[model samples]
Target: MADFAWSLGSPSLRLGVTGLSRAGKTVFITALIHNLTHGGRLPMFEPWRAGRLLGADIRPQLHPDVPTFDYRGHVRKLTDARVWPDSTRQISELRLTIAYESATFLGRSLGRGKLDLDIVDYPGEWLLDLPLLSKDYRAFSSETLERGREPRRTAIAADWLAHTSGVDPLGPADDEAAGRLHELFAAYLGAARGGSLALSMVPPGRFLMPGDLAGSPALTFAPLDLPESGEAPRDSLWALMESRFEAYKDVVVRPFFRTHFARLDRQVVLVDVLAALNGGREALVDLEMALGEILGCFRPGRSSWLGQVLTRRIDRILFAATKADHLHHASHDRLELILRRLTDRAIARASFSGAEVDVKALAAVRATREATVRRNGESLPCILGVPQEGELLDDHLYDGKEEIALFPGDLPDNPQALFRPPEAGEPGFDALRFLRFRPPPLEVTAEGVSLSLPHIRLDRALDFLIGDRLA
Candidate 1:
């Protein structure tokens, strides 16, 4: 056992998890906790493979005021009900005490290695709010409006764009006017997020997740058409929107940042790249833009002893392409390549900050198995799993009970090919099929011990994110 005096003084690394809605934040956390505590197969995680990792156990909440993550409840749903856990609706916390053996003789002389891992889960939709701190209302409005004018967004942003184009920023401020304009803008944001469009650049994030501030005036402001060089008249429409916008930054975003986000030592941004691909190239571009902006907000760098005393900076950031089990094993590398290329720019910026950055394709929990099927005269690689009911693919709608094999199309080996437009009749990404899969039943050993959740490259994710700390 480690001595409490010295061991307790060791700093705990808080890992923040966030991404777009349905990007699997909740599921990822659930799997992380489940795997660590249960001794899941993790050959790539050095501490585990070296036989230095002992075990992990849930600990008391570090912040008692925050709601605790429902790890047990989520496990029951995945193991018993055979379904995916729900997405993150609000900020939640989980703390783990990781016990291990020291790799170094000096560390062994002191005591065994142990660490407190504080995990923070929050809605990714609201993540873009962090950047609002540096942006003035005019800059925000300009950027937002410019994006709305893009070819793909033009139709979805029609009503709000038309209304804002006519708004007189110098007009007298009226509560009713503000409410109406904001309603239209919020509708456009809703439409942008709805169904298959799946655009990720939707900001004024509070508009999407307004918890208690749903109808408050602070949330009732929308971007307006204003001149670039002059200020609007005092107490004008622009003034109202600007004040509320600032209030959003000060009253809402800042507290969350100071309390939770700024304190993180590591972060994992889960991306449902497959969903974005299914939405089309426009969605992919928007996803890239959103990810880049979100990454820009992270104060990433090496966390030295002095730096730790002065301020906290995320020293490591992992960008994971989730739902890897949807494709055959042969296509895993291609998917990872596509993700790295997709976020290549963001990865470059983060890396320049002196932080270790990497991208991996993972499924947290594997819900499918690979198989080879003979079609006509050739052998085709496919994945077998139970599709969610009513899911239509290749003209067959699944009934949610029967297992089926799907031939996921191949991805370009050349990552650059994704950035370029395809020929008129050419199809690669657009031809692939990605289907939703139910959680697979756990396999039991002869002694009745159920195996830990199966996954694709999740061990690599663990190795990259926190393996060094364990060492």
Candidate 2:
């Protein structure tokens, strides 16, 4: 049965990744695939040398029904900016075919098989709807209302909270009061989404696209609200609230999961814990709650017993805190702490539920270096980083401070906390101050290119997802 199950007709791995908008999925996938194709330098795995013909040739997927991604094109655009244009909107899917040769147990070579890897990219907006799967109006409204109190979101919350106060929490959900709240919620999302108005996943383009919607509506929403006024009980309001919550789950939540979530081989969940830390206690609480709820979708805790017994587990889950390039090298530890705290709830869920999870605080791209400058008798940490687009100050003169050697702990949510700059500069303040990510130089030798740690990380992640079949 095990051999039969591992046959070519069966999928060796099914990894799923979920992250908020601007979380760096495209780059991670692109780099992982790029390194896989050129695995000479990678640890433990033999590269696909030209003459050796390891038997695995990455071809465009031959699935007649599913769409194939231009993996090479995206890679070129990411590596060579002069080629394909940058991606601006959410692409439907990026699928690739990875075929390779692995040693067989019988001391004889096994037939070459294909690995169909699919990565579906969608908006983060839809992710916010998952909690609704198990929530009612009062629960949803109150939560959204409470979340509105954050300093960054106070401006938007003022309008919806005021309107919610007039409605009877117990009144029918579709009552005039309920209707007003619904519209306000939608409007708030629209404003948060640059008036996309549709309650789907807000894509990364909204944040990094450079078009409109940069500092948009903040995508703020209240969880269910309790009756603020001591009015008579109105049960209809509860009914209305429940119905809308259901509508949100069915219309928005289910489709994304069915289409995108269910098709992966490995998964990564990105959290912006630094922003939450900067936002303070309320933001932290909200971040924790959001992380918990989002992780619930992938855990076996909610799976049916049959699913737990039969379906493949989401073997490797990488909870990465993105935008690591924002901070200097010294404070990477504190960033890890902040991230661990923020994700403790989800980590607990995965741990108790039997899923293998790795929490990493990475910048996906190393943006800046910790350099030093000596002023007077004291030395301070300064950033010697270049920007992604803009030109950096061109000066080779050193002020004694060289980039500090920082071995980042696991990736963190609050990258800023882990930042220990050699010297303070006004420019490198937040996530916005990141240097463009450059791939580590390929180590070449007499044989071919060699593998590095990043390449190993990808290999292990892949192995966990489907090593048995690949081997």
Candidate 3:
């Protein structure tokens, strides 16, 4: 079993980086490591600014079983190729050792201090599955089915719901029947995740992003409409799914919690709030619900026998609204406010005693620069960047070669404005034009050494997460 307790020797801190698909988890990790190792300008980071930080370098990852994060390859992809690195599909780890001088006189007299910072990268999809631990198969089925009937999901779920209508829960279990249902259900989940819908809370996370369990019996089970107040018949479809669900919890979810999540000392949840806003009210609400469920898994005061035996509680959590570069600097604080309001209920529900929770709007790899454009004799704040190939605006498709200044619409002054659905003829979040931008070109020094990736508020985020420890 992985050791949950930290050894007293050189201090080690495990920082978890997780977010849903396209939320920039991979880029965030890459930028964080690159900044520290390459001595990127992090004026807000106290240790670095105070001249206490000596040096930072990559070290051998502690976990042999988990794959090392491909930092070098990802760096090449971003700096050399000028394209974003691939999104995270599985759990990976990277170790960075920072040597620093202690601020305290007594500590400085003792000697230099070295801290091992272990960065754990994993899919946010898997975090959604943590709620499964508290729910039975029947509850899972009923809840999933109810959500599928929601207005935002109903259309995408039509084919799956239609297929489920013909499925008999009490009918004898058949491989063919189960396989067909699983396929349809997985398809619905995929559709819900695509485009402007960007729906969250799609559970049985493996259905959408099955890493290795693809085609396994554990993954083949889909939620079915079960009759109320009756036990599942032996050898029936319900029984088969229930068994597989339980097996999945035991074989997949439990191991992850015990081995990785429970050991983390700090965590960063990257959120693409712009995407959620672009997706409209339904998507925003869905993201809130999903975030709440994920936070519930980290409920504080875990003093149970198993909790005591398994892992320590995370002390710091940072929920970051990523891709802040998409908006003008003026809207960054507004974006942070929106995220804070979005997750307010979730933070309260978790009630993490002795833990500090914070939210910020940040871009780990800044893809745009601020500019002011005059339109109709009025100056407007804008962002200038190279839009990715095929990006569309005003019926014009970008060829990816020209630099353009876009006046992405402003965020509401009141965060609550995002919660309510728009009224008839009212302009909704659709007014905001968020285009995917390619990674910025890297700057090289006179000696040919490449500077670190540019970012917005990454230093403040790092300070909040690990500055105290470095001190």
Candidate 4:
């Protein structure tokens, strides 16, 4: 019914853009639309390369309730101020109308084809909440508690764990107690996501990123130590927590699944694979589990023209490892392979459901340009760019304006090596550095026209994502 209503209003292909925190969802959408609108170089995009892609324009979507993607403001910040756009916090929409000459002879005879591309930007953290639908409060609490007890999480989750240990599920309902537990639990989640530790299994995902539901009772509940094979008394704290958990799944997760996720014709899940690598084997394994849950939420399947008209199914899934600029071009393929390895199971699941799934390593906005420097009388591949202020590496702190060339470590050829425990003498993730870089300065033409944001493999990604639709 939802898809029918959506299709009745607009004949557009909806693309879901989502990623884990700091995976560059905002930049990808901004750069993609900017390149198409400004005619930025897109050789790998078939329609753009063949001169069949005429032009593109952003159109206001029919839904007034959905906030429009702030394309212009983001462009102003990137081009005029030379800074990255703020990360997305809430859901937003943008529709790009592309006028293109059709590739087929018969298609050309019919005249120019215009494809309305509806881009839906949402936080991947929300997608992490999907599994909550099937999980009861007891199960959810059990899983979250088990994760908190893990060795890696022991320190970060100490306060929450200690506090939760004292809370009884069958105790009298106390709003203050629930709120306190929520605070410590949320703190543990936030700390786990910090730079030094990149754990990803923090679910009730909205707890960490509570956009509008911050202090509401819907967000106040926390895990409690429950007795085995027990029932909660009607007026007990467990009952309140369970009711709120159900309310969260009802009020938050289900609506998103029905209204937005279920309507997507395609999806690209961006992963900050480098950060996961930095956190070592446990983080990598956690990421894999999170991805499995994420992949399972998607309704991926092959649809005939008639089938598509009747129901919306995501027919293509792109799992992109974002921030390719952090590594040199020499390791891009290795990076892609590593992501491919990480998501191999999820890809199989999607493929079995009849969706075309592919993976790539991409930097939506290329922050660094490549260079070669001689060190110890040997040429070494390095990337030249400005590191953000206060970023410390090798005992040198960047002032955010000074540009420097760096040999941002290479990804290993064997993707499996990343998952295995390091050998005594093995130069592992500890040996590498992944520093954040500011957005590159835009290229200006002689006439003072600014070109589109530079990128790596973005064109190819677009080609695989929407090329067939344009054709």
Whole-model lDDT per candidate: 0.83, 0.49, 0.88, 0.86
Give all TM-scores, in the order shown: 0.91, 0.63, 0.95, 0.94
Q: Which numbered prediction scores highest in TM-score against the true structure?
A: 3
Give per-residue lDDT, candidate 3, residue 116.
Answer: 91
By lDDT, the best candidate is 3
Residue 159, candidate 3: C-alpha displacement in angstroms: 0.7
In the range 340-393, model 2's lDDT, one tens digit per residue, is 666776777656456666665655444355566676876755555333333232
Q: State the displacement of the C-alpha of residue 336, model 3, in Å, after optimal TM-score superposition.
A: 0.4
- Those runs of model 4 whose alpha carbons end farther than 4 Å from true positions after fitting are 1-10, 299-310, 349-351
> Which 10 successive residues of model 2 have the least lDDT summed?
195-204
Residue lDDT tens for model 4, 1-471: 222355353347889999878778999999999999999899999998899999999986756778889999998898888888988888889989989998999999988898889899988889888768768998989999998898988999999998898888888888998899989988999998875788787888888777777899998898888889878898899999999989998787777776777778999999999999888888888888888878866743334222233246678989999999998999999999988898898767655456788899999999999999999999989999999888889899989999999998777899888888777776788877888898899899999988888999999999999999888
Give per-residue CA lDDT, model 1, range 402-462, as digits (tens): 9998898877677676667886766756688888988999989999999888877888998
lDDT of 1: 0.83
Higher lDDT: candidate 1 or 4? Answer: 4
